[model samples]
Target: MKVYIETYGCALNKGDSYIMMTLLKESGHEIVENYSQADAIILNTCAVRLETEERMKQRIKELRKIGKKLVIAGCLVSSEPALVMNLAPESSLVGAQSVDKIVEAVESPTRRIFLEDSKELITPRVFEGKISIIPIADGCAGDCNFCITKLARKKLRSYPPRSIVNAVKEAITNGAVEIELTAQDTAAYGLDINYSLPELIKDVLEIEGNYMIRIGMMTPELAMKEIDDIIEIMKDRRVYKFLHLPVQSGDDRVLKLMNRKYTVDEYKQLIKEIRNKIPLVNITTDIIIGHPGEDEEAFNNTLGLIKELKFERIHLAMYSIRPNTKSALMPQVPDPVKKERMRIANKVYEDVAYSVHSEYIGSNSLVITTEYGKKGSIIGRTINYIPVIVKDYNKLGDWINVKITEASFFDLRGQLIQ
Candidate 1:
């Protein structure tokens, strides 16, 4: 069978798709590069926000018109199985936890829905390009008021250290130059299994490899609990000097309303500590513009915080009311108001981000080519994870020195120093 797999959402979802593709290939199915050529299409989806969920639904509708068999996987299966069945009644439904049964779902004439808790890990993945995404854990320990992901991915279930270590070793052995350790909350890993993220990193680093490991997003509260150990592990040269900790809001009141456990002050202090120890680290965060109870003052507070922190990257999004979440029951922010606040927040973020990136306009650094960019250009990342685009053709996974010639709000343009 010729299969086409499309993935959405976080790195974890992408990793799951990789595993599914590897499994399908091992089962004697050919993986097709084009959706039109596939005998069946598998959409690995996301439902973190209402917008994403709707987008995924629309995409399924689009794919259904092609007359090919469809398979639905990922969070959407657990979050809105009924709606999925309504949209594509003939499609096979394989939930996020049941990815191992993808072959059965595709081959079986009857519909298959696998929503049971799956503890299996260490699945083989087809590494693409120079990067390989490895999921260290699934789900998370948080119960944020507005999060539908908590319902989709329940509880913290960390993969065994031995399994994760073997996966990492396999990736590096297969010429993977960048390994991304992803989860819903990477710092909360091992809470259910008595393992720590630092310990996992130590085990991965012990493998003989010339690659760098990039840590995924972790909530500020959980990150704070393991700060000392995390910082120590980050000092290793094998790890990227980058941190992604979403602050969400800058006002304590808004944070409390969002059910965030940590205060804005605590978030700031964590950033301070990381910068003090790893002075050249790049810090990125997420900010929601109009969450419930975020009045003008709260919005302004978020703007103020972004200006002060000067985040290397800001994932600014408007609050989306998701079904079955606590925040949906509160007095919702007006859509117009959310749009206005989002505009102002976006301007603030661009200004602050451009200012931070401006400092790299004339620096020289060693970057590993990761992906292709626009107009035949190539994209690479510095040690701090700042994206650099060069026009010269370079082999993937090769380290090359480049001089920063220009800067954008989010990335840099570089010329290879020949």
Candidate 2:
């Protein structure tokens, strides 16, 4: 069978897709580069926002039109099975819990494989791929009020530490230059099993990988408990200095309303802790505008925090109510208000991001590669996940010095100082 698997959403899904790919190839299936040349089309879906869901729907429709065996996976199909089925009746759907069985589906995808978990639960941190994503945990353990993933991914399943370490080594062996350790909450990685995130990271760092490791998003609650120790492990050159912590709201009251379990002070402490340990670390975050109860005061508090933090990057999104979340039933903020807040937050992020890059106006940065740009300018990211453009391919997978020639609000234009 020739299988074409297309993935969407976050890094976690990317990891799942790779593992599934490995399994498919092992099962003697041909991995096709084009969907039109395949017997089946597996679309790894994302449903973080309305726009993302709409995009998946459109892509699924397009694939079905080509009349291939379509399998829809990821957060979107997992969360709303009936809705997805109605949209594409011929499609087979699998939830996040059953993601591991995607390989079996591919082997015999004429039948739907509702694979959420393996009875074995043997997740490896190292797999065979240069661009690899390995799961540290599954679902999440937090109880945020407005999150739909909580319902979609209902358990706190932590992978065995030994298995994870082995996977990391395998990926490095396969030429993986960027090893991403991802899950619903990577910082809460081993809490359910009495181990901790620091312990898991310790084992992973022991693996001999020439590439860098990326730690995924963590809530303030989990970060507070392990940040100090995590900071110590992150000092290793293999660990990237970027921290992605999502502060849904900056207002203390809104935090309470959202059941985030952390107040403004707690979130600030976590931020301060990371900054104190890793100087000039790329601190990025998530901000939701116009939640059901967010007022002007709450919005203002978030804006102020963004200004103060000057996050290397901010993922700004308008609050979109989901079917099962607690906030959906509360008094809803108007759509116009959400849009206005998102606009303002994006503005603050752009302004601060530009100012932050100015300090590097004359410094050298190490980067990878971006898909776009003309011959003279190629793009890549710094160790901390800061976007940079360097005009050289000799250093494509290897890190090289990029002398800053100019700085833009979103990226830096530079030349290889070598």
Candidate of highest lDDT: 1
lDDT of 2 by residue, 323-386 (tens): 6789889999999878877888888888998899888888877776533456655567687777
Q: Could you tell me how far off, in angstroms, the CA of residue 102 lies in candidate 2 after the best superposition?
A: 2.0
lDDT of 1 by residue, 309-353 (tens): 889999988999988899999999999999999998898888888
Compute each candidate's TM-score over C-alphas: 0.98, 0.93
Clashes of 2: 12
| Residue 217 error, candidate 1, Å | 0.4
Clashing pairs in 1: none
C-alpha displacement of 27 in model 2, angstroms?
0.9
**What TM-score does model 1 achieve against the real structure?**
0.98
**Model 2 alpha-carbon miss at residue 117, Å:** 3.5
